[model samples]
Target: MLCFGFTFLYVPMVLLIVYSFNYSKIVPVWGGWSTRWYTVLFESEEVWAAITLSLKIALMNATFATMLGALAGLALVRFKSFRGRTLFGGMISAPLVMPEVITGLSLLLLFITLGQLIGWPTNRGITTITIAHITFSMAYVAVIIQSRLTGLDQSLEEAAEDLGAKPFRVLIDITLPLLAPGLLAGWLLAFTLSIDDLVIASFVSGPGANTLPMLIYSRVRLGLRPDINAMATIIIIVVAIGVCLAGWLMMRQERQRQRDMQLASGDNIKQD
Candidate 1:
């Protein structure tokens, strides 16, 4: 059942990729295969501009979301008994559960209100889209980091303190190293979400704020374009490669940690 489910989900994407090289723009048809569409995609300045904008927003959103989420995760995990903790956690995660349309509308209203009151974010553009992306992205990031924090060995932190390391130094040297994998995972997820966003971005984005997805959406609505297929194929390949790389890195890190533990145990036995 699980395999069937996975296959069902991926088959359409696989078909799309296969059809990307098809010479017939009508799709699901075979004409003599050609890479011409990819060539066109590379040469299109408009497409390139959208891609650049998306990448920039994704990078910035990921950085800010990851940092904010990490701090929130720490607070939630380490200080569970704080006043209004429940309300705070609920507020942090509200965006994730809210409908995209609702979230977008709310953000737009907030932007309007802020503009009238404070004169910031004067008009929607990259900043508005990025803020919306970060709003949701950070919720997922916080959840990931909090899960990792919950599973971490608290004794390691205590040992750092016993060794005369200050609290901040212990956090930097001990906690941060152990949490590196979680942070990296959270950052990657946040980046991917930001890059692929559409609905919220659509509502928040103003004139001249089209992202790659928005550009694609506009072109797709007109009719099938071979260039779109080529772009989709490239994105699928890139996403697959990234997933494989992340899995490999995580496995390698886990193996190294286990080996270190074994070596430490061996040294302790020898000293005894």
Candidate 2:
């Protein structure tokens, strides 16, 4: 079953990667092996522009989403009860449940109204797209941090407070450190969502701000293109590398944390 599931998931991606190297412009014909498409991809200014725009939006969206999400999660888990807590939670979660079309339409209207009123963001573009991405991605990040907080033991935090640490200090020294893995995961998830987004971004983006997804989507809709396959392969390679790097860093941190806890335990036992 495991093998079946893996095959189901990755077989198409592998085929796409293989087809990227095909010599023919006509897809599925397989005229032979060639790297011409990759050459074309590198030389295309529009493709490079799209890649830059996508990366720029993804980075900004991930950073803002992670920050807001950590705070929201802290509130949801630590505060327990507060005025307007239910309303706040509903707003935070609304994007998660809402249809992408609806979300995109609503954001489009919002930007239009804002531009008319303030005369700022006078046109829809990267700023509007980034805002839309951040709106949805923030919810995903919050959910991640909230789940991590749910499983957390709060004794360390209480002990830190008892030992003369202020609330902010406890957060910085204990809570945030413990939440690091979740935060990193949330950031990566947010980045992926922002980069992969087509619907919401399409609604909000204007001329001169084509993201990679949008560009690829447009080409895919028209017809089969081997350059598209090459683009996907490159993205897959970059994402796979990033995931492996993150996993390794997380494991290293976890091991170090466990070792420190053991050392601290031994010291306490000796003192006692």
Candidate 3:
């Protein structure tokens, strides 16, 4: 069953990667194995521009989402009793359940209203798209962070406070470091969602603000081409590399944490 599931998921991607090197212009008809489409993709200015724009938006969205989501998570976890806490928590999680079309429509209206009132963001482009991505992406980040905080041992933080550390100092020294894995995971999730988004981006973007997904969708509408296959292959390779790197870092951190715990246990045994 596991092998069947893996095959179901990755077989299409494998086929797409294989056909990216086809010499034929038609996507389905493989003339012969060649790197012609890759060269064409590299030389296309429009594709490159879209790729650049998408990456910029994804990076900004991930960063802002991580920061805001971390703060929200801290608020929900750390502050036990606060006025309107339920309302605030509900708002933070709303985007997760909301439909993308509705979210996009609401944000579009918001930008339009803001423009009319304050004359800010007169045109919707990267700025608007980044904001839109962050809105929905942060919800996922917040959930991850909240779960992480919930499972974390609070004794270390209490000990820090007992040792004369300020609240902020304890957070900086104890909480944030413990939250690093969660933060990294949230950031990567946000980045991937932003890059993969099309519905929200389409609603928020203006002229000449095409993202890679937008460009790909438009091209696919016309017809599939060998270059499109090549682009997908490149994206798959980059994402695979990123996932592997993140996994390695996470494993290394976990090993170090286990070692520290063992050493602490040994010292306690000696003292006893």
Using lDDT, give the best candidate's number: 3
Model 3 worst lDDT run, 10 consecutive residues: 21-30
Instruction: Report how far off residue 18 is in candidate 2 (Å).
Output: 1.9
Total clashes for model 1: 0
lDDT for each candidate structure: 0.92, 0.94, 0.95
TM-score of each: 0.89, 0.89, 0.91
Which tens-of-lDDT digit does each residue in 150-232 have in candidate 1?
Answer: 99989999999999999999999999999998999899999999998899999999998899999999999998788999999
lDDT of 3: 0.95
Please count the clashing residue pairs in each candidate, in the order shown: 0, 0, 0
Model 1 residue pairs with clashes: none
- Which candidate do you rate higher for lDDT, 1 or 2? 2
RMSD of each: 2.6, 2.9, 2.2
